[model samples]
Target: MRILLSVLALMFTLGLTACDMNEGPAEEAGENIDNAMTDAGNAVEDLCEDAKEGMNAEDEDC
Candidate 1:
């Protein structure tokens, strides 16, 4: 009986862990937003670098 109970507990724990491993909708949306923000930041940096080059600045790196 003890072994059976232990096995059941182990199975239950495994099931819970498996459920937690999958990403939910909210997490997906948050990841998308993060990626978008990163892209936007990179674009802004590129624009800054371009503007600096146009001005013939000493440091063209943004």
Candidate 2:
């Protein structure tokens, strides 16, 4: 039917527009910055734990 064909065409167009196959430079740079910040936060947490263990603190949970 014409209605079925129209529905299929609408769905196909939506599907094509929703997919992005390329990653732009700014997006890549943002991802790198996010990763670096996460790494730094983890390193700081580890350092804090190490310092707590070295000091023989009773609560040793960082």
Candidate 3:
């Protein structure tokens, strides 16, 4: 049991150290964020189209 605990602790420490490593440069991060925003906008546009279709169908039924 003690050995298992020590191994777990060592693994946790190593994982923490890995996370501490420097991330990608700011420029790349900005570009990735911009791409994510564009994707989100496209998704929202598709949802709006779906809502419009539903509203039109409802109008036809009434």
- Against the reference, the lDDT scores of all candidates come to 0.97, 0.94, 0.82
lDDT of 1 by residue, 1-62 (tens): 99999999999999998888689999999999999999999999999999999999999998
Sort by lDDT, top down from the best: 1, 2, 3
The candidate that achieves the highest TM-score relative to the unseen native structure: 1
Greater TM-score among 1 and 2 belongs to 1
TM-score of each: 0.70, 0.69, 0.50
Q: Once model 1 is optimally superposed onto the true structure by TM-score, how far is the C-alpha of residue 31 displaced, in angstroms?
A: 0.5
lDDT of 1 at 28: 97
lDDT comparison, 1 vs 3, better candidate: 1
Q: lDDT for model 3, please.
A: 0.82
Q: Which candidate number maximizes lDDT?
A: 1
Q: After superposition, how far is residue 3 of candidate 2 from its true place, in Å?
A: 12
Give the count of colliding residue pairs in each prediction. Answer: 0, 0, 0
| Runs with alpha carbons beyond 4 Å of true place in candidate 2 | 1-15
Task: Kindly report which residue pairs in candidate 1 clash with one another.
Answer: none
